[model samples]
Target chain A: MSPAEHLADAGLVQLLTPAGERVDHPVYSPLAAHLDGDALRAMYRDMVLVRRFDNEATSLQRQGELGLWAQSLGQEGAQVGSGHALAPQDYVFPSYREHGVAQTRGVDLANLLRLFRGIDHGGWDPTAHNFHLYTLVIGSHTLHATGYAMGVQRDGLVGTGDPTRDTAVVTYFGDGATSQGDVNEALVFAAVNNAPLVLFCQNNQWAISEPTTRQARVPLADRGLGFGVPSVRVDGNDVIASYAVTAEALERARSGGGPTFIEAFTYRMGAHTTSDDPTRYRSAAEDEYWRQRDPIDRLRLHLEQTDELPAAFATDLEAEAVALGERIRSTVRSWGPPTPASMFDHVYASPNSVVDSERAWFESYESTFAPTQGGAR
Target chain B: MTTERITFAKAINSGLRRALEQDPKVLLMGEDIGALGGVFRVTDGLHKDFGPDRVVDTPLAESGIVGTAIGLALRGYRPVCEIQFDGFIFPAFDQITTQLAKMHYRSQGRLTLPVVIRVPFGGGIGAIEHHSESPEALFAHTPGLRVVSPSNPADAYAMIQQAIASPDPVLFFEPKVRYWDKADVDLETPAEPPHTDAAPTGLDRARVLREGTDVTLIAYGPSVAPALKAAATAAAEGTSVEVIDLRTISPLDTDTLVASVRKTGRCVVAHEAPVLYGTGAEIAARVTERCFFHLQAPVLRVGGFHVPYPVAKIEQDYLPNLDRILEAIDRTLTF
Candidate 1:
């Protein structure tokens, strides 16, 4: 199946077409109606900024500044759109590539590089942004998200009728994660417990080297239906559709409608990471196909044609994107290794005798060596 | 103080009840833990008193049970997760090791997951495969996790509460064989609140169950019983054996173990896990390293064979029984 076939699949909820036309769906179009021209422009700006950050990180990896990078190149629409749909109290459990999602939560993008730079495991405080630290292991955080939603249920934050008082949880993953036992188990748990969660799957065409077809015989959205979750497929490249679909799911969850699974049919425009090589596995024609359907460009075109794009807005966003790229480059270069003894910190929340004793022994052992010139020792 | 004689299983149940009563945040989750009271009836009656929300009968999925428990903990709820059995914990190993254990460190101490994973461990229950096994060492080897086991009803009652109250993730290994073992427990003494500024003690420390002089026989969980029996038998032959029950596996009570070994000058560590790279191997290595000068003999170990846990009919031949412990003790004493 080609990208065109998947995009035109029946039952796909899309509020905008690939050619920058504003289309409508009886269900999801109403959800996106609240987003005025300004809101849509903000979403576009977010996608542009996050894409710039991602590209800079990729360059950093190539320059040997970072160990690796997971680019959210083409999937920015799905991320920014859904991310903007989140309420302040709604927590997020993101897979490693949700940089755009992290930006939506107001997380400093520079701090995220600390992990790739090998200075820290996860540099940001999750509670500060109501966004969990990026979970690297595939499908692992899905259960955590379900569990968090279950926590929301127990806290009486669901079905409160008052929008401000209710909360929901959203977890992001790729097509590959659906095959993981944890993901399927999470679906079962969320369904049976009636957890207020949105299992957002970005079917970004490939999981590293393997294509989505290798992950599932049926549409990825259909996987959730078996678990009793209301599943939907959306054109992930359509920002308006992504936003609307996510908003609807979040509303359902907040109103105690239980878990919903949204499969965002998208494409990974870049290599899986700096460590991956798409040339060996996929065709250039396919890459070009997705690039032409670029999430940022499509939104930019729609905004321009609709007269929502003020001339200043485009120029200002371009300058902002350049500034973000520069900030990331400088911040990543300035990062240094953490203190040697700091490795022992936070292994346990409280004092542990083994850690304390080992640390003491290490300090004494290090003291045996004379200080080297220039503090090299 | 109110005291009562109860089985180790009932003691754990009572301790869980107290934790649930004291803190609404603490909830139980496991397969069959609710209506079925778990496969071993360890959690019997908790669902009735606490309701399904509090004592959740989770799907028959170990990883989901633990993974969600981590999420709940992240949300400020203290989740007491049950792993059903020792062998069953392997499915959730990735979540427990990578996520649950590392979340605090990953968050740079900004987050704490107060999750207690109750795993019924050890052999000699004469059950089917995967039902009886001791996988505590695997958890103990991982950083950011507290692995502890109770050999008696008193410790079982107190330790479960302590594990649940802890700010760090704890692998509470229940000795399945000793679940029926009866002992007096002080029910009134509240479990030391983990958030308090008191000195670190209790479940993280080892207890000198029996005091002696000639040799120190150290064990934990199911082995503690046979160790005491070995000590008593050795006492008849005039060799005073000091038996140490390692209530905590990880962050081992090196102070107590080394002190005992230094006094006795001979040591024998025992457990139901295979001796090869088992908890006993760690105890032996640590005891030898710390008490190098005080040692009168090389440290010995008594445990199951390197082979897989055998069938119930022939499990005795593979298990570390009182005779095997005594033999190791005699070897250490005579050496």
Candidate 2:
């Protein structure tokens, strides 16, 4: 069978159907008690704002404001559900395309644009929010997250049974990163060490132009079973399932249940990046199929059916999204280029004579150029 | 001051022991470092002394070893990773260059990765193809990593501790061939003492092993010992050859190099790597730029041939020896 067919047969843990109906599984139904009318509405609002930010970022890329943009259009439920499931002490290591995860972590939406605007490598203090900088290199951050989890173990933070104090680590990567050696190695280390880690694989079904079938023959979640990690597959469009599964996994880690692999089965509804043309590699039929299961619309529909979301609330949310878009547009346009000497500021923690000498030489060389020409470049 | 005669391998072991004892955060991780005590036995008895927790025997994955070590550093632990052999380090090259080397810079100084990667480097022993190779130039070319090698037992004992204590990530390249060579090491002396009245010899500066006026022989790691031997042989022939052991390869102690070259008017760089795009090329470029008119002859380099490190039987022809170094010194004097 094809990889997609295998995933379909694998019996994904889903709490909500794609047609805006609430469902239940024997293992996951207990988690539905935590999602009241207010909580469900909050989750819907979170998805709407995250989509707004992602859309604004994509538009900025097309309008020549950003160097590049990776949109999280269809994967909002996967990101937001898992993001909201974390404890405040839990650390997050993200792949480059996690704009929704960044939103849930309280990162200033405008600051994240600095990376794509070419003004900074990473703009926010990762330590401030317990969310690490985005790793562009695929699959590398999984190992880092595992190691940090090991550190958490060493610090006597795990197995404490304190909901407010025990720590766990969550790492996000796409289906494409599963093919990297670093990711496989990370699984080995995490299993052997029994580190308190959760491997959140957002299986968006396409790694650039290649389909998920090209990367794996079995279900992606089953790959974790070989490494001794417990595996589960969740319908990523069902935010209820994503949040419940991740929350249970994080609790398992804190209570010394070791690492768990959670494959959030989702799809990419847009181009991989602003530079990619998805139409060349994929069929419109497939895109239309995934569009019917749009994560944001499904959550909004569920809220409407429950009468938890009023018309006034939807109108206010639309206005809030427009205001957010305008703020990002103005902020991006006002950012100036960094000084040339700023490049040498953080190469080493301790002073390096070689870098210092090179910085001085560069400053002297730049001085030799005419002010107009130098400033223009 | 107390001194002891020990092999270079023992000196490194002693250094690691001191580092582990001094700082509770320091830990060791490698493929066979725990029970096997490393292939070269450089980490022998460390696991017994510190237990398996401190000296960890990791899976046979080089990238995982390095990538996880960076994470451990982020948690405020100083991780000292071992890459088994010189050629085997390629698997972990991406982690070392892209992540470990750039983490501090990418985080804008908020994250400091105090990671030390210990690699057994260079060729001289009659080992297999991958075992005997010099790839120091590849690491030295990367920014944010401090690459250092010790030529003698003293520097091996002292420099390893300094590399671990460094706030920045450091690549400590151990000369596998010189592991058995012996020298006097001050066992009680801390490399960088907190209460020292005198300035300690730093890891960045090059040291003048022997002073001469006719020519200067500059080398690091395994090549430094051969350069010193070649200088001695040249001295017996009435040619004064100065020898400088470059403890740090990346920073390129050009001050000491230029001062010696200015006095001697001649220079020769020696290493086990190929001359093309090797550390020698960087030294030559900087020497020419700094001391444009000081030399009576152009800077010469003695290094491995532009070919793969040959098999056991013909390995001598591939590596630079004392005779080849002296031949380059003779050629320099003729000018």
- Please give, for residues B1-335, the per-residue lDDT of candidate 1 as tens digits: 98999999999999999999999999999988988998878889999999999999899999999999999998889999998888899999999999999999999999999999999988897889988898888888899999998899988998898898789999998989999888899999877654333634476788898999999999999999999999999999998999999988987888899999999999999999988888889988998888999999999988988898999999988888988988888888776
Per prediction, fnat is 0.89, 0.71
Interface RMSD over true interface Cα atoms for each candidate: 1.4, 2.4
lDDT of 2 by residue, A275-347 (tens): 9999999999989989999998888888888898899999999999999999999999999888888899899
Clashing pairs in 2: none
**Estimated TM-score per prediction?**
0.98, 0.97
Q: First chain of model 1: TM-score?
A: 0.97
What class would a CAPRI assessor give candidate 2's docking?
medium
Q: Which regions of candidate 1 deviate over 4 angstroms?
A: A1-10, A370-376, B193-201
Candidate 1 lDDT over residue span A258-367, tens digit each: 99999998999998999998999999998888888888889888998999999998899999999999999988898888867778899999879889888888777777
Native-to-model Cα distance after best TM-score fit, residue A1 in candidate 2, in Å = 3.8
